[model samples]
Target chain A: MPIIQINLVEGRDDKVVSECVREVARTVSRTLDAPLASVRVMVNVIKPQFFAVGDVTKAESAAQKDKS
Target chain B: MPIIQINLVEGRDDKVVSECVREVARTVSRTLDAPLASVRVMVNVIKPQFFAVGDVTKAESAAQKDKS
Candidate 1:
């Protein structure tokens, strides 16, 4: 069984997050020739400060006014 | 830009991994009404030992003979 976890900045709607998980799991199952049931998808929405992009913490948005 | 990283057990076909990345990115962009260019997807494949599910390291597959 293959478990997939997606880590991204917080602020996503439930619908979008759920769909992304299902799609990723489906694609992997089909491409790897594994049973769909064998794949699992997990979503981890972290504070922007938890992630950094070129020395800038993406999680900063969680505490800032910017929503990007 | 939002970067999406998918961490999973290794041994998946290239086609599947690529598709999963694109699909997750697309879904998040559409559902969140964010620019497609702002969403980034990154995949980190561990050696199984880095991950544990119910006392079993999923990455153990990287060293074991059984492919789960």
Candidate 2:
């Protein structure tokens, strides 16, 4: 079984999320030649405060932007 | 930066989920000799209905169990 896990910053529309899950499973199955029914896709939508880049969290960066 | 993604079936306490994320980040940082500050951990808690095994969803299996 092939498991695909995706991490995304929260705030996407539900429709986009649904399409993403479906498309990713389809693409992975096709690429790996695995059965579509056996593919599992798990998505994690993280809050901005929980995601960071270069030691600055997305929430922090947003706040800094507001100050400038 | 090393990113670690974990997929877990839902129904865990919030405390446990927090601890899991923290411990996993620490372990990955230690094992990979990476800076803890530079490591990122993402946890995906999937709904039972969306997770499957052998083409049977967890929700479906549970329903079957209730029927028996």
Candidate 3:
């Protein structure tokens, strides 16, 4: 089974998530020449504070209002 | 950024998820030589019905109780 997991810190709306799954599924199906039934996708959303870069958390950057 | 996403049909408990995140973060850090703060891990839980194999959904297999 081919399973793809997408990580997102933002854009967690129902529309976006569903559309993403569809698009990713199509891409995986096409590239791997696999049936849609065989491809699996997972979208994992993390909180802002839990994800960081260079010791600066997303929450910190959001607090600065894109000042980075 | 190197992001790793893990898909799981089961094991969605709080303890399991948190431990998974920590373990994945550490692995990424060690293997890729990335800082712990820089590695991101997302755990996506998928429903049984939505996932399938060979036209047979996970729900179907689950219903069959490992009769595959």
Candidate 4:
């Protein structure tokens, strides 16, 4: 069984989310030679405030960029 | 950096969810001897309709259980 977990920033369109899920499942299935039906894909969307890099959140980064 | 992804069924109390995230990060840090600040824990809450086992969604399983 191939389980794929995807982490994405929140606020994407529903169509984009569904397409990403489908594409990921298809790619994983083909690459791993696993049955498409047996593959499980889960997507986790994180708020910008909750996602961070180098201790600075994405929300904070965006705000900083707006100031400069 | 130790990044931990946790998959959970949706509808838990917000307090419980926060506690779980804190506890998991602490446990992973302790067990792996990684710095607490370096451990990242992401929790993915899945709707019952989106989660399945043996091709039966959790929502369907609960409905069947109710009938039985």
Runs of candidate 4 exceeding 4 Å displacement: B1-43, B47-68
Please write out the lDDT profile of model 1 over residues B1-68, one tens digit for every residue.
55565666666667787876777677767755779988887777766566776776765544465654
Give per-residue CA lDDT, model 2, range A1-68, as digits (tens). Answer: 89997888888998999899999999999999999999999887886655554344556678899999
DockQ of each: 0.35, 0.13, 0.15, 0.11
Q: If ranked by TM-score, best first, what sequence of candidates would result?
A: 1, 4, 2, 3
What is candidate 2's CA lDDT for residue B1? 82
Higher-ranked by lDDT: 1 or 3:
3
lDDT of 3 by residue, A34-64 (tens): 9989999987676554455544456666889
Off by over 4 Å in 1: A59-68, B1-68
- State every prediction's TM-score relative to the real structure: 0.56, 0.53, 0.52, 0.55
Name the top DockQ candidate: 1
Q: How high is the lDDT of residue A52 in model 1?
A: 78
Judged by lDDT relative to the true structure, which candidate is superior, 1 or 2? 2
Please give, for residues B1-68, the per-residue lDDT of candidate 3 as tens digits: 56766676753565555566667778778888987777766655678888888899888888899775
lDDT of each: 0.69, 0.78, 0.72, 0.78
Show the lowest summed lDDT stretch of 10 residues, model 3 chain B.
Answer: B10-19
What is the DockQ of the complex in model 4?
A: 0.11
lDDT, candidate 4, at A18? 58
Docking class of 2: incorrect
Docking class of 3: incorrect
Interface RMSD of 3: 4.4
Q: Which ten residues in a row have the lowest lDDT in candidate 4 chain B?
A: B49-58
- Ten contiguous residues minimizing lDDT sum, candidate 1 chain B: B59-68
